[model samples]
Structures are given as C-alpha cells and as structure tokens.
Target chain A: MNTDAATAASAERSGSLLNLEAVVVAFGGLQALGGVDLKVWKGDRLALLGPNGAGKTTLFNVIAGDIKPTSGRVIIKGIDCTELPARFRPRLGVARTYQKTRLFRGLTVEDNLYLAQTGRSGRHLALLRSGVDAEFRERARAMAETVWLADVVGVTAGDLSHGQQRQLEIGMALVTGPEFVMLDEPASGLSRGERERLVQLLLSLDADITLLLIEHDMDVALRAAQRVMVMNEGETVASGTPDEIRVDPLVHSIYLGSEAGLGGADP
Target chain B: MSPTGAAPGRVQSRRTLRRLLSARNVVVAAATALALLLPLFGSNFFVEFVMTRTMILGIAAATIVFLAAYGGMVSLAQYLLAGVAGFMVGNAVVAQDAWSKGLKLGWNPWVAVLFALAVTTAVAFVLGALASRTTGIYFLMITLTYAVIGYYVFGSITPLSGFGGITGIDPPGLFEDHPQRMYLALVVLSVLVYVAFRVLAVTPFGLALQGIRDDPVRMASLGFNVSLHRTLAFTLAGFTAGLAGVFNVWWNGQIDPTSISIGPTLDLLIVAVIGGTLSLEGAWLGAFVFVAANNYLRNLPLVDHIGITEARFNTIVGVLVLLIMILSPDGLAGIIDRIRLGLRRLVQLSRGSGAGPAEAAAGSAP
Candidate 1:
C-alpha cells in the first residue's frame, strides 16, 4: 500500500526484476514473516544475511512461489505472481536451490542437469530416447564441467560427496538459464577449500544473471555479493554495500559478533 | 605413443563386443528363441491352455509392475481394468442369442477391441486421478476399493454382465480356427510389451515419472506437473491391462464376474512379486511359475504326502510369496541380478586381477 514515487518509478523501469510489497506469511498463530518489502534489480548480487530463526528461508520460499503470502503482492518482472504455483515460476526465469540439497539422488549428474534444462519447456510425455536430445545432452555435459563434475557425470547423485552434491544443486539451477537465481545456504556443510571454490563459482557467474544468496558463512557471502541486506526477527535491519553493512554497529551487535573474526577483514 | 593409441582402439572394440554378449542379453536372446519355438510342440492341452494362459496373465501382471516399479504406485486395480476390457469385448462383439443375454451390438471384433481399450483406459485415468491424491498405503487401499467395486458392479448388472457371465463369446475368426495361432500371438504381444516398457524407462517421460516417484515435491519444484505424470502413468497401465482383458476373454471364450473378483486381483499381485517387480521380464516368468504350480503342483506325490490338494493352491502361493518377500524383496528378478553379479565377481577373481575396462563394461550392462 506504501507505493512511494521512487519505488513506483523503479517498478516501471526495465532493470527492476523482483519486488515484494508488504508480503506477510502467518502459520496459524506464529507470524513467520511480518510485513516485508524488498526490491531486486537486474544484475545485482544481493546477499540476504540473518541469524537462525530470522525467517530468511521462509522469505526465500515466498519469492520462489513455494509458499503463498497471507497478504500483499509478489511482483516478478513487472508481473504480479502472488497466486502462481511453484511449477510455473521456472517459465518466468526463476530458479532456486533449497537449504537442504534436493538433487534427484537416484539419477545421474547428467540426467539431473538435463531434467532441469528441460523441465520448463520439454515435452515430458514424449517417448523419445534420452540420446535423442543431442543438443540438450551436450549442454548438460557442459554444465557438469562448469560445476567441476565432468569426471563423474555418469555417477548417481546419491553417491556424490556432500560438497559435490551442493555443486550439482547449483548446476541444476543454472542449467535452466534462469534470469533470477536464489541459493539457500549454498556454503553450508562445505569444507574450507570447497567454500573457496563456491565463492569463485558465484563471483564468476554471468553479469546478466541476478543472484540472491542466503549464506551463513561471512567469508563467502561478503566476498561474493556486492550489496548486502541484513534481517532480524522478520524485518530488514540494514541494506547497503557489503563494506557498509560489515562496519554497521547495529549489524555487528545483532548478527556478526567478535566470534566471526572474518567479519571485519577487508580481504 | 603410436602403439598406445592403436592398442586403446582395439581395447575399446573388445569392450563393446563383450558388452553385446553380456549375461543379461544372452538370457533374453535364449528366452526369445524358446518362445518362438514353443509352437513346434504341436497343439497339446498344455501348450494351448497353460502356456497361452501364462502369457495373457503375464501381460496383465506386467502392467502392475510398470506402475509399481516405475511409477511407485502399487495398484490392485490392474485385473479389474483387464476385466473391463473383457466385459466390453463380450458385450460389444457377442451376438444376442437364446443363451447369451447382453447388448450384442454385433460390432466387428477389431472395432470392439479398440472401443474396449478406450473405455478401460478412460476408467483407469479417472481412478488414477482419484488415487494420485494419496500415496504409499493409501494408494494401495484406494485401488483395492476400486477392484471391489468393479466386482460388485459387474455381478449386480445382470442385463449387461449376466450374473452368471456371458458364455459362448467367440474369439475373432483368425484365433478361433487355430489355438496355436492364439498362443503365438500372445507370445509376440508379450515380447513387444516387455520391450516397450524397457524402452519407456529411459525416455524423458519415464525418467520424469521415476523422479516423481522418488520425490513428488522436488519434481514439482523442478517444474514438473507431478499429478499429471502420475495420472498418465495410470492411464498407460490401464491401456495395457485392457489389452490383457481382451486377450483373457478370447482365451477363455467368455467374460465373467469371477475373473475380476478380489481373489484373482490379489493373485495377479502375487504373480508380479514372484516375477520380480523390478524386472519387466519377471512378469512372464512369474506368470509361468504361477500357472505351472496351479496345473501340476497338486499332482505331485510330495503334495499328496503333505495332504495339500488343488483346492488349497492359494496356500502354497501365499507361502511362496512370503518366502520371496523375506529372502529377496525384489522377487525372482532380484535373484537373477544377484546371480549375474556373483558370476561377474567370480570371473574377475579367476582372472587374478581387478576388473579390466572390458570386463567392467560388460558387468554394468543392463
């Protein structure tokens, strides 16, 4: 309802991608997300940082259309999509990964990536053989290489290591050529070396692909994202350049404490 | 470097050759040859009655396997769907006479067959939509309920189903003249259905169905219509079951309410499990074992010593099913897979080295 002139003008601009206006979600008596407003512009690498139970994942689900907000609007690419179901979101160029890895464990890495590539537009009922899609098969193999999984493309996903599964999850999301990608805690359960590689992968993404990351690792989040938004108890507490949020006294007290020694490092 | 490159090409060709002659392929080829040669035995009661019945029952059971193994839906309505086709064919093709009382449309047999398939598939789609809302045990219960309803409906509808069932329902002229032709036709159709199911498993639709079976929520999030895929799988299974129904009526020369009853419905489930729910070929193998036990087990001296007779045949089947479930949950197919794997391991050990690339390729075939 609070449509300010600046916000209205931004919504009309071609650069505007996702806009949430007073989005609220209530599970019976508990209010998971109390009225929240956010805007994501094209090509922006935005990090959503919040402590545990701060409703970050819940908000991510709302944006991904997995959960409908109790009230208010979800605008994606200048279109209202609050009532749209999750299956149709991919056609709108929206792709996401869950906090818990949701790869098709019984399928091979190539099959997993191929399904993602064809999920939005492929004729799922066609009886054509898997080898018939020579073009998509090539693209899936290329995606496997992108995620550093070229050697084990034929291996079942359930056999992959924890860090490798995380990489495959990202590869599935990117294979669809989505314009907006949301990754929920991509760095969780990853080793130090894997985390560094994840950050490099994130930073090297196409500039045209907007990324919305929910990460707990301060090192990965701060290094990969150019702009950061901090949330606390279901409200946006601060939004600015990553460096500004790192130095904010409120952000420090509520989220980053002295325990996170990497929080203040410039590197 | 030149010698190494030429050697690698030779090894690749050798691996390909080994893969072509893998154990699974050899078994399939041998089975096909045996089925094709079965007519040479001449028209005995065993060939016409027992073997033909096995193929027909196997086709019905294969539909059950398709849904359970690939789609993760353990439906009990497969036999009922087959009965639908049988009844439709009976009603559509059978001429009204003094003894037979029915619609007696007197339509051509081929037209009647297609109509029956369409009607049964439609019914399956509807029932599938209803069952797709539930999963696991609930799905089984719903499909069982449908089978029960079908039995009662057919039994109560005398004008159409004839409480006693329509008799003297003749097969098409081509099959009516020669019993061996019918048997051979069934064998050919069964083989085609098996091949089609195997091919479907690797298709995009088949892979997506497997994905939905494993995790419907994940499939939905990945932009797949989970409910649609499930319902379509049911429809496809229904069509296959309908074909079995048409064959059943032709084989028996009649369609009756007793065929769709709960007892026979569960028997089909037994057949599928014994064959190996995981392997399409297991359907026929299970059916052959079931038909053989039904026909010959009661005549054995061992059975007479044990005081078990033909009337208690189900008791023997129950014990067999229980043994299969306990020893090998995947059924006869699982047993076959284990044997093949064991043989491969033994060969590798006999060679006194780890598996070479060619041996490894052959080991993973199928």
Candidate 2:
C-alpha cells in the first residue's frame, strides 16, 4: 500500500464516513466485485479509475445501496447500512447519478430539480401542497443557475442535449445536500467545454461534501479528485495522489500494456 | 446569456396567445354545459339511466387512468374494488328477511355507503401495499389475480350468488321514485370525483408518483419513498372506485357477481384505453362512447334488417375497441393531441413561409 492507502486504512480504523470491509458482490458465476476493502473519509474527493469491467461501478452500486454485497459489511457514517434498501440511503445523505441519465424525462428541468430539493427538505408525501413549492422553486432556480441551465429550466429533460443532461444530473445529485455523492461517469459523453465546466463544478463543490466518482477521462478525474485509486479485474491495482499515480509503473503498464518503454528505471 | 434565450415578455405574450387560440377551453365549457342541461331536455331513460350511468362509469375508469397514466401501475382489480364496496352496501343496507338471507344487517343506505367506502378504501390500502412492490406486468398480474379471487369468492357465496348476487338495494327516501333527483345526486358525485382527481394530479404526492413511474431507482435515490408513494396512489384510485361502486349499487338497486367479473373488468380497461389513459376527460369520453354505442348500435336500420340482436352488442363494441386500439394506441385524447400539434405546425409553417417577419416573430415567440 502507498502512503495515501496507509492513511486511508488508518482513517477506516477510526470510523471513516464510508467503510467497505472485504465486500464481495457476485452475479451468478461471475464475481463482479471481488472481496474488496476500501475506506472513504469525510470531505475526501476520490476518483476511482479503471478499465471496463474493473468493478468500479459495481463498488459504487454497493456503496449506494443499490446492490447488496454477497458478504462483508458496508458502513456509512459508522453505522452498518448493508441491510438498508437504496431508498433509505438518501435520507442518510447518500446520493448518486447514473452512468446513463435517469432523469424524469417528462418533467421540466426546473421540476426535476424542484423534486430533488423538496425530497431533501419538504414533505414529499404532501397531497394538498404542490410539489413545486416556492422554496423548492427558489432552490431549483439557484441550482439551474449553478449548472448553467437557467435559461432552459422550463424545457423537458428529455429534450436537453447530452452534455446538458449530464450537467443536470450532477445538479440533481448536488441539490440534495448530500454528505456523500457518488457520480458514475459524469464526463463520459461531454464535449471539451462541458467537461471543463464539469471539472470546475466538481472542484468548486463544498469541502464538507465527500465525493466518490468513477470516470474514464483521466484528465478530468485527476484534476477533480484529491486521491486516485486504480482498479483492475475487481481489485485495487494502485492508490496514490495524481502526481504519484502518473508515473507509477503499474499504472503506466496498465494503461499502455507494455513495460518496454519504462526500461526498468529506478524511482 | 443563453444563445436561445427569448425575452420573458415575449414568452408570456406567446403563452397567452396560445391559450386564446386553443379550442380546449371552449370544448370543455360546452361539454359541461351540455352535461348539466342534459336532464332538462332528455327522457327519464336518457337522463337518469344513460347519462348518469355514463358519468358513474367514467368515474370508475378515471381511477384506472389515475394509476396507469400517472403512477404507471395498471390494475385489473379496480372493478373488483367497486364490487367489494357494492357488496358491503348490500350486506349493510337491505333489511334482514327471507330475501336478505345471511347478508343484510338492516343498516341505513347512507351508513352502508359510508361503511362500504371505508372498507373498500382499507382493501385498497392492502392491495396497494402488495402491488407497490411490483411494477409493469407483474403489478398487472397481481391485481388481476386479486380480481379473479374476488370474482370467485362472491360467486361461491350461496346467499349473495343467487341470480348472480344480492338484490333489493334501495336508495334513501329523499329521491324515492324520482330518477331525475337520483340523476342530480349522481352528477354531483361524478363531478366531485373528477375534481378530486384533478386536484390530486397537481399535488406533491401525484408529482412524486409520476417521478416514481418514470424512474423508480432515480426517485428512490432522490429520497422519495417509492413503495409508499405507489401505495398512496393506489389508495386514492381505490377511493374513486369505491364511490363509483356505491353509486352503481344505488343505481341498479342490486349487486351481482357479474359486475366484478372479468367482463366488466375488461369494460373498465377498455374505457380507460379508448378515452385516453392519461386524461380524466378521456375516461369520460370513453365512458360516453361505450354507453352511447351500446345503447344506439342495436337501434340502427342495418342492425334491424340484418337481425342483429341485443346479445351481439358486446361483439360490436369489441370490434370498435380493436379498431380504435389499432388506429390510436393513445386513444381519443392522443388522436386529438396529434391533430392539434399538426395544425399548430402547419400554422407556424404557413406564417414562416408566406407571412411578414412580424407574423413569424409572433408565432415563434413562445
């Protein structure tokens, strides 16, 4: 383990914001997530980098309570939340955006954000008051402004461009005031400008909010996250800062698939 | 600062213009006026039996529309829910005698209706609880199973099953022998049910239910209780179905096993489909079409000459339903929506191509 992993391990001993103790998730004969132990401290920005089928998204799903692990424990804020369904996790300040946009397509952008805002604070089960409450609308307006979608607030979400949809998804995750937000491939289909905007948005997030993101775009991921963990075949291959991981032999070999270019240089 | 941003004043004016140009409000006003004035012009059979029945049936179908359109939980057990309430009214109201068998308990009709509504609402809550955990076809199957169970349970009851089910269910003395008075009460009830549906649609609960329908996992992650919202939606639908059930018994002065059977279940489903599953107005239209077609189809000269009998009415209705489903999957409302959109586009196209710049600007301002 690198120094960062060592520190994260010690932080887990002291009850980190999120802890996965040898969590294993198997789908039939295929083990999507091998027994993996991980820790995310409060206010930490973690970028999970991996090739396809590396189980980063699976790990995310387990943490988000979408999938229960085959064995081991998932502790959120010092409480074991392995048994709680995904819906209950949100009340505990866990939020996530999907790889594919999972927005309410029929609803306007403002309405979608308003729903998220109200879900966090308003009486969501209220039958008399409209869902588009004044406070919620205000918050939605502010969030739309933050995501640069203010002008299109009335547009249905399905009608937005792909990049705008991704921005709106991120805005939705952020609007809930979640202590822990897990974003799955937020920069997957973005143009350069949209990716820069997303990186800026991620970087400018409140320090009190912990973020765990899965991204294939190494540039955006490295810039936005404080710590990076590279996984291969459902196991952690490397863990360190962006600068350390940039030159790591394992990372270089994993990405480039050849050790010949390195020529066995001493670190 | 947006590239596509139009002025707020321009948007508002365009919205107002669209509203003024739209024929929706005019149609609604005319329909409401015609409905309210129906009793003043029509015969007792037309006024009380046909129109009132249509409205009551519309209320029942509206429940399905609420679930299918908003919550995305299509159910076949809603008519069964109505039957439950109808049976409750029968069990509570009809005086205990040789005709009552073991069913009647001698309660007043008003009390019976209230008790039936409450019980059916509770049953709805139970069904909602069970059905909320499922979605799409599984949800439909669960409700269908429940409906089948209800049908057989009522069918097996010796006292209630005679000549299909219970009879001699009389309404209160206030409207005694006055079909017009009964019709008036039904009109009020139907209107109240529809208004309640409208009120619920714009509420937080309804919106949350819609969110759940569109994407359950997303709604769950956003902190909305998906199952709870679904259950609540089902319960609301059940309340409307229950009211229709009570009114149905009062109208026919009896309850029958056939009323809750698959035949009527399909009838309700057809009503929702034909009118438009997404709109209450569609439900009313479907009901009107179903009732009017059933009433008038056999009276045609072609039918009389070809020896078409009353028993073949369902066959004709079935063919009509199949034709409508093939032509417009979204039903009558969807057809109307398509026509409106096409007309608007044509108007815009004509203005953009031939009219002056000012006309084009006005048309596209919104």
Q: Which number leads on TM-score?
A: 1
**How far off is residue A234 in model 2, in Å?**
0.8
lDDT of 2 by residue, A1-267 (tens): 265456545655684889899999899999988889998988999999888999998998899888999998998876678988887777668889999899988777877887886665547888766435866777887999999998788777888898889989998998888889999999988998888888889989998899999988877888888899989888888999877876788888775366653332222
Q: DockQ values for all predictions? A: 0.49, 0.45
Docking class of 2: acceptable
Write model 2 residue lDDT over B1-366, tens digit each, in one string.
112446877766666767555476567657777887888888878888788888888989989998998899889989999889988988888887736443778898789889999999999999899889999999999999999989998888866555557888887787668778877787777777776776676577777877888889999878778898899889888988998898888888888887789999999999889898887789889998999887877888888788677888888888888887899888898889899878877987878864444443333221
| Predicted candidate 1 versus true structure: per-residue lDDT over B69-185, tens digit per residue | 888889999999999999999999887553685678788899999999999999999999988878889999999999999999999988779768987778889999688899889
- TM-score each candidate: 0.92, 0.90
User: Which portions of model 1 show Cα errors greater than 4 Å?
Assistant: A1-14, A129-132, A261-266, B1-21, B356-366
Kindly report which residue pairs in candidate 2 clash with one another. none
Kept native contacts, fraction for each prediction: 0.52, 0.64
Mark the regions of model 2 whose C-alpha exceeds 4 Å error after superposition.
Answer: A1-15, A130-132, A256-267, B1-26, B159-164, B353-366
